[model samples]
Target: MHSRFLRLAVAAGASLGGLAASQAATIGLMAPLSGPQALVGQDQVDGFMLALEQLGGKLGGQPASVLKEDDQLKPEIGQQIVRKFIDKDKVDAIVGLSFSNVLMGSLPRLAESGTVAIATNAGPSPLAGASCKPNVFSVAWQNDGAAEAMGKFAQDRGVKRVVLMAPNYQAGKDMLAGFKRFYKGEVVDEAYTQVNQPDYAAELAQLQSAKADAAFVFYPGGMGVNFVKQMSQAGLLPKLPLYSVFTVDGTTLPSLRDAAAGTISGAMWDAALDTPENKKFVAAFEAKYKRTPSEYAATAFDAANLLDTALRKLGGAAGDAKALAAAVKAAGSEFKSVRGPFRFNNNNLPVQNYYAFQAVKEGGKVVMKPLGTPLKEHADAYHAQCALKSLP
Candidate 1:
């Protein structure tokens, strides 16, 4: 009777272990899902969900659950959502921390709890530098990277005097700083408008009066659409030479369309990239959603792949934050990114190529044609300031 009881106990323990090993991961995905940024958030959600569906509704060969939250473009709301995910939902990981400000507001809790958070959109300068957290990873480019590319392109193209404009926010400041870093020419005027201000008449008038050879700006989502449209209406687009970053990409292209023609922008990835992985992703995305995937979508898609590879390395155990972070670092080197070349810097931000693109009429449609690569295998300016020592 004792021997029979011992055999039953051992069998029960083994079954429980198997169940634990096969447990599904839970991911909390936060984004600005309403107001001006709704489309941006939808693209992120769609891209991630598409990747999840393609991966057989599993991450790392185990079923996964994704809890979606809308930050509404507010930092306070974002922090609350993060707290709920960590405290109430007990999520294994968090993705899509929205824009830079929201991400900044939520970072303290994420760092304190050692929760592995991946920012598919925001890569704030502070996080990339001295305040870098080992558990936080940004699958997207540093906020400055694309703007730096445009600045370098403008400099190379002999655009000596330029006006700089952007929404007054963390990303806006970072974008202007990045542009100045590479462009050594004179800045005619630096104008910062309110976030989602809807109108750019005053800024456009100021820009026109500056008489700068070109204009450089960083406006994403609806701001990009509105700004570019207003610029076109003011007859400054094709005539004045506009150079921008994150202002003429897939996210705003549909709205801007021909109005954005002749605009030159810089970014890490575009649908025009001639890579097999990118082609497949773009095709699948358009087929499923009937729209071109934005850079946000591409980054979030890559985030899903990165998470899959990481969880697979840990045999689906995402509960262990330190172990999961290590796995994510290892996976970064292993996963084949949809973006041409991608790897993580020691600061856990991306090291990738930045390209210059010209939006022009091709086949009677406005397309972002690849002009050149201004920065290759580029690491962020703040990476050197990071103190995390483990990653190579």
Candidate 2:
């Protein structure tokens, strides 16, 4: 009997140690890696890694472990990966989701599990409004905010007629709606192309016939490169002004260097954002990766920093989900972001500044020059609909 009691005590102690080890705080990154949008996903990963390095591998003064899972850019795959992260890996939080569809599919799981998800990209309106969940937060601007800023800029520039195009998806629809919200001009043609359509020859031909004053689009990833290259080849680049959002950011800039020149885009942050955090991030990213970080990367970096801020406030304690949630809510209160002052709206989306940027070449490198600053402290139109009061 005495020997059996001693053996049981030893077994229990070993099990307890394993449980404690498994409970160590970790952040999971779910992103596409094996699809056309992999470049965007990779950028997000790089940005998150840079943030982790800056923090010396610690968040909230406690050492953190990062677990990465490939979502494959498919909604079903994304859902599976998120489930694995929550169930198998037992990650305390999730960050750096890159696609709108993926975010939508994974949100329900995150909400049900009470797992905090800090989106580095993809702010679908449904998540920001009707389907909003307290556990889901965004470091990136809402899908429509940047495009709306561009629409307003186009209107201000006296663009009377414009051709609009986007992929046939939730984000694409949201982007078109956003542009139309502020454009107040004739949409000579509103085209919804297949999500992965590579050739824009048909659409470009249509735009030529329409002879619109300008063209606005929301193509990202390889679609942006293909469309811009074809647009330039089809002789439209010089004929009509091309205004876009999410079409000329960091991921596509290098590939679209010459083709994207003279284009105008609207965004919350550019690689050239003039701020200390941005400067450091850009320098570090270029130094380590040999390329300028894109807006996706910038947002991922912000997400990581936001996570770090939340963790620090918690003093490295683990397992208090409610307290961690509160800490996350307190994140933007003190941290200065690359895009300027930002705070979470009632829907848990960011309130940030948006800028109009014209793509220009400087010393053979593509750069964005600030054309106008639209919102010094912008609040989304949906904020009033949220019942949550502002953070004190």
Candidate 3:
């Protein structure tokens, strides 16, 4: 009986010691890795890994494990992937979603589990507004936020009659609405094409017939590349003053080359953003990838750093949902973002700067140059609709 009691006491002590130690953290990144947007997804993954590598493969001195899964850019597949991460892999955190449709499918599951989800790319309006949750945060700006900047730019540039185009989707609708919200100009034509549609010849024909002073577009990923090249081929490149959001990006711009030149676009991050954090991030990314980092990759990089900061504050409490939410909010309050200063609004969206940039030719190459700041310390328009009792 004495020997048995001693053995039991030793076992109990070992269990208590294990409990006191911090557990290994797992972060599951879900993005479209096998579809048309594979390049975009890979960029996000690369950005995230770059940050993690710089941090010495650890988040706040705790061992970290990453589980990456492809959503295939399908909503159902994305939902399944996220569910598997939560139920089977038991990831402590969730990050990365390239498309808003995939984000929409994953949000409900994230809300149910109350796990911290830092959106690296997609920032749909619903998540920023009525459907906002405590655990869901966006390292990227709201989808409309950048569009609003473009709208303000057009309005300032004296564009009176502008044509707008996007894919027929939730983010597409949000982007157009955000553009119209600030443009205060006549929309001569509006077009919503099917997503991933290779041919924009028909849309270009309609635009060629229209009498718009300028045009704005919100195509992203492969769609942006296809549209820009097709529009250029259709004899609309330099002729029409084309402004876009998320269209003329690093992922698309290289493919576009001269076709993307003279195009004005708005984004939260550009290589020319004057800041030490941005310079360091840009240098590291270019050195690592041998190319410029897109806004999607920049945001994903920020998400990793932001998660690291929050996990450090949480310490051993990283697994605690309520505590983790507070830590995330605190981490976002004031962070050295690659894009510059980053603050979290009440809706868990970023309040950051937006710049109007034009694609220009330099040294026999096309590059984006910042023209001016359209939006400063910008927050989403739908934050008031986010009615969450949980506050950090």
Q: After superposition on all CA atoms, what RMSD does each candidate show versus the true structure?
A: 7.0, 6.6, 7.2
- Predicted structure 1: clash tally: 0
Query: Which ten residues in a row are the worst by lDDT in model 1?
Result: 5-14
- Scored against the true structure, residue 258 in model 3 reaches a CA lDDT of 95
lDDT tens digits by residue: candidate 3, 159-208: 99999999999999999999999999899989999988888988999998
> lDDT per prediction?
0.84, 0.79, 0.80
Clashes of 2: 2
Error of 1 at 341 (Å): 0.9
Backbone clashes in model 2, listed as residue pairs: 60-311, 60-312
Error of 1 at 148 (Å): 0.7
lDDT by residue (tens digit), candidate 2, 196-230: 79888889999999979999999988889999999
Residue 253 deviation, candidate 2, in Å?
A: 1.5
The local lDDT score (0 to 100) that residue 152 gets in candidate 2 is 91
By lDDT, who's the top model here?
Answer: 1
- Candidate 1 at 304: error in angstroms? 0.3
Error of 1 at 298 (Å): 0.2
